[model samples]
Target: MRVRTDSHGGHGWERETGGPPGRAPSAARAWARAAHPVPVLVVTGLTVCLAVSMGHSPGSAALVALAVFAGQLSVGWLNDLVDAARDARAGRLAKPVAQGRLAPASVAGMVLGSALLATGLTALCGRRAALAHLLALVSAWVYDLGVKATAWSVLPYLVSFGLLPGVVTFALPGSPAPPPWLVVSGALLGCAAHFVNTLPDLADDARVGVRGLPHRLGAAGSRVAAALALLGSALALAGAARLGGALGLLALAAAALTTVAGLLWLGSGRGGVRLAFPTVLLVAALEMGLLLTAGLPSGAAG
Candidate 1:
């Protein structure tokens, strides 16, 4: 049996020399890949955790998770659909749409469906939560539409991520506002994520005429910015925890060590630049863990 490989570098589909052809399974895989599943799952998981921590009922927490998952799906799909032409032009065949393994129209349809589902689910959480999430979604859409190529690229991430905690807190009974520290920490971490996420793609982005804040900062500067943002986020969380009487010294220590190690690794000239983003992610996870343990506002507790 002979297999037909996508010359654009996408997953190869199975073709028989004289038998039945296979395209469905590979196409499905491509669709899934195009969804940007990793970040979608991560964001959804974090929302669920925050909902549970904020004293939401099990049903409400589940609703928040489903809503966030749908919203993330919409955002991811729209990103791919909007970037299809650019990706194709840049020879980014790893993108299923760019490689012709998936149709842009189909992806656009999914984007609409998921966005509607997300809106409906968020409305069920309550008007406040719904409004906050709607704004967040709009911010993400703005980034996909055009802000991603400009100096203000980080604005959307700051707006969207800072609203995330409020999306959970407001869904709870009485609709209490999210704590200031939580919002600040989330915004800083989101900024760090933006810088780190853009690092490896800086060259590709430049080739495609995309020059966000990170592009302007250059790689080394972006790395430093990401590290500082991560450290700032950690400090904010730690300060909140300290006010709550938990000290948070351990988490702060860990974040500091992780930041130092990451910077040192990159500076060692051992091709460790790839580890920079992962380091920021690790600090984010650590901050989340601290938030779960000692950073939850008393008013937010069930």
Candidate 2:
């Protein structure tokens, strides 16, 4: 069936009942699409970085890694759930059920299952970590429900991202509570994420009344906000390094490079399609690198 064209940049595919000529989206394909593996992969990478940076025990590290996967799954599935109508209207091939490859009911089931898994696993981490995980889920839901459309779209990111490192560290046996600087730095990175996440869909979002901080700022303003976030994060990390040592410096450098690269991408002549995916990829990388920095030996980092 035909539907309105996507105002944002995403692939266009015709919805057919018979399925793509010879191709099929089986249980594996459905799972992949439902899981939205990219974000999960990025989060996993971040967990590793954190483990190395902090010299976490293997068991603790494993739990944190699992938390990342569970967290991303919750985020990804919820995104699809909230956007299902929009995807239907836009005839979005990028979405699982929207392309007629999977059923909406099935996707909903996946969301429920994943969220339950996340909650159970998080509880094992500790009361504090579990609370953080719950907070992240709540923040995401708030964003989906219309907080994101308000001035508060940024709040969800701040709360959610800030809690991440703490949750990981909390999982460790006998480790001190997460440092204030790490959480603060994470909040700063969240601000950047708010901008970067909204880049590709600004147009479609506007078209469908999904205006958030990015829409309010417009493209130029959004880009500026993104750059400033990077700068601010870098400065914070640099200061952190002064107090904490070499790993801080390396983290700051990584944050700087990440911000610069994002700004460069935004400024490029390339259309949103080409730019958005890469930007997302870079943002994920930056987060992972920052987390990993804590593990690098002074000499190795230098």
Candidate 3:
């Protein structure tokens, strides 16, 4: 998020101005400076939720977070690297890579090392878990590489999020898939994320020749899709929570109401409400994840 500003007041990947000096490797080594950590944290938080929901040990939760961090870091860095030129062209100042504050080589090195570490950590989680999580990572990479320009971009998010619950469940001794509702709700949440996240970038992306689903849908269509997806996720969570009695149902209702309130609040785009839409959906997704955990079998071991 720390962009090196160009004379044109844009990120400077297309220009040499404000770029880190070639000899100053130290500049590229700063973790906080080289990349935006918000998305990484969000993804890693989901991994932690997975471990906890599956009744895994604390160590497992930490390990899951670490593995997810690696994969998210690699994919996120790749996104920046691959889109540096496009971002510069779009005058985006939010990408460190596009700003030239971060060296592509350094970011690429991090990607390689983190991906290898992610593989090992996921393997430690168990072979089935490893495969599922790795597939999720691959799906992300596919989006970063070439899929983002196509209408099929939503496919990766669906694949990855659906596989995520399996990753957690399969890490146990029996290697079970998560309940059907869990997978369905998770995928819906992810699909909603695709719409919501892409809505802000639709114009910029289309300008840069990236005609993903959001671009094709246009602003209004994308918003409708995102809203519908979120509502569907809420219903799925509510259904899953029904078996747990009134308390669980109450929680689910609360989450749904929150989602509705968010939609209404976002309608006004009051102050920063529009900017908070993604975060609101993320919280709802986390609530849905918690509801999914309610049905986890007692035998699922730490």
Q: Can you give the TM-score per candidate against the true fold?
A: 0.88, 0.79, 0.82
Residue-level lDDT of model 3, residues 150-255, one tens digit each, is: 9898999899888877877777767776777768777877887887777667667888899998788876666667667777776776676434656666766676
Model 2's TM-score against the true structure:
0.79
When summed lDDT is taken over every stretch of 10 residues in candidate 3, the lowest stretch is 267-276
Across 1-302, the per-residue lDDT of candidate 1 in tens digits comes to 11123655533322211223465666667877888887798788789778766767789889999999999999988998888777777777678766666656677899999999999999998999999999999999999999999999999999998999989998887888988888888888888889878887788889988898989988878878777877788787777634443545576657666775576455334355666666776777766666566545437532
lDDT-superior candidate, 1 or 2: 1
Candidate 3: stretches off by over 4 Å: 1-36, 241-245, 257-273, 282-289, 292-295, 298-302
Model 1: runs farther than 4 Å from truth? 1-22, 241-248, 264-271, 295-298
Off by over 4 Å in 2: 1-27, 242-258, 261-268, 271-273, 276-302
Candidate 2 residue-wise lDDT, 1-302, digit = tens: 32233344332223223335543445456557756786677657766677667776677677767866876786777776677677777655667655545555665777778778887887887787777778877887677667877766888888887777777766665534666766777777678767866776777777766778888987777777777776676566556552444654665576567656657564544475346445545644654565564453322221
Q: lDDT of each structure?
A: 0.78, 0.66, 0.72
Question: Which residue pairs overlap in candidate 2's backbone?
Answer: 49-291, 49-292, 52-295, 53-294, 53-295
Worst window of 10 by summed lDDT in candidate 1: 10-19
